[model samples]
Target chain A: MNDALPPSNQTQHSSDQDKPNTPITPNTRRILLVCRTAPYGNALARESLETALAAGAIGAKVAMLFLDEGVWQLAQHQKPQGIGRKNHSAMLGALPLYDIDTVLVDRDSLSKRCIDLAELGDFTQLIDSLQVKEVIADHDVILSF
Target chain B: MTLHTVNKSPYLSQCLADCLDRVSAGDSIVLIEDGVYGINCATSETLSALNKAIAQLMTLGVQFCALRPDIEARGLQTTSANCPFNLLSDGDFVDLVCEADKVLSWY
Candidate 1:
């Protein structure tokens, strides 16, 4: 409720007319997609993965972090057929093909859900909360779903 | 400053609280989608706590806003005197996004 705006000199605005079709620079942006929702119950998990894949496909340096209930997304032996939904766990295997191999999951989240690292397969790297913060700070863009 | 967009009802999810926790001074928060339910200002403990949070953050120069269309769709009443937040149009929302260095969406 501070009606006062930032100093006019400090305000930054990227007017649509400012740069038309800006070229992709050699320094690709580092994007970190964070997933905190369980799969099947909602579209968040699947959408987050799709976003990560899309960013990677567009040549952005993409990384993913699974936290909270999001760790369940990597659980093995998932059979979503009963719900008439395709099992999205298998799609995670295709991440490496998009050059997005740096997928991290919170260790505490997995333990709280009674999941083991082996169950998440070899693609995911189990990380602690402290390391998770480091990964967040390292990224140029952070998208949470 | 970051542009934080909350799209879930505060009563249903911790999205607003989580977004507030991560916001710093001068950051702006826009209640959109179901988040427009938060500005109801009805007689309730949750609304009081939310009002207090908004007032306190305002002291530190944090800006609070709500999407106009969502408010209208939900039939919520807001005015400069009664409401503590600004109501913005879709175009204004886009401008706010351009002004901020980063955007964070909470649902």
Candidate 2:
């Protein structure tokens, strides 16, 4: 295992770092990726995409959830040309191709944002935030971006 | 167990340091919500830098995982490589919290 020590905490030596969070055995490790922002505002959206892509590439059964403003990342009819930017919607359209096709958007966020169910591009699912909570409860890992 | 989570996007320039700060050598990080932003090629000099980072982090003994449903909805889950990436079910999330003594969020 690669070992990189923290600078300030170096002196507070603890064997905690050596402990394995996940064993090499079967079915023990998992992660949940949660996205709550649309692209173009900042790297949060891009980071969410890249991180999910990275996890999937690693052979992990990663789970991703979209909540709050995060649902905007999946909105339909995205045109970045007005902003002179590449369309994130286009990139999002390609996620299923990477084997990461469990996209979920919060139902409330959709209503709050006035996103029509029909507007969602192919490969996206719209579920209530309550369902999202259930989804998180079932995972071995939970992360928010 | 120690979980070294990274919460910033690669393009932001703060995530690298943030990861280095919160995550250690053996801990694992699950990409969540906007925290997934760190991997976009828009800011990556290398198209696979985000993937490379995940690989590199794992090599350091840290496990890296991401949420499946979110990416699936966002249409971004296909970006990752095929490794032992974890997709936690609701029960698993509870176990994660129970399993780890400390949980640090980058947000």
True contacts kept of each: 0.32, 0.09
iRMSD, per candidate, in listed order: 3.4, 9.4
TM-score of each predicted structure versus truth: 0.65, 0.49
lDDT of 2: 0.64
Candidate 2 residue runs with Cα over 4 Å from true position? A1-28, B1-107
lDDT value, residue A100 of candidate 1: 93
- How far residue A50's Cα lies from its native spot in candidate 1, in Å, is 3.6
Tens-place lDDT digits, model 2, residues B1-107? 54444545556544544343334556666666555554343234553545565566667787666566544545664343554367655466566767774454655
Where is the poorest 10-residue window by lDDT in model 1 chain B?
A: B40-49
Candidate achieving the largest lDDT: 1
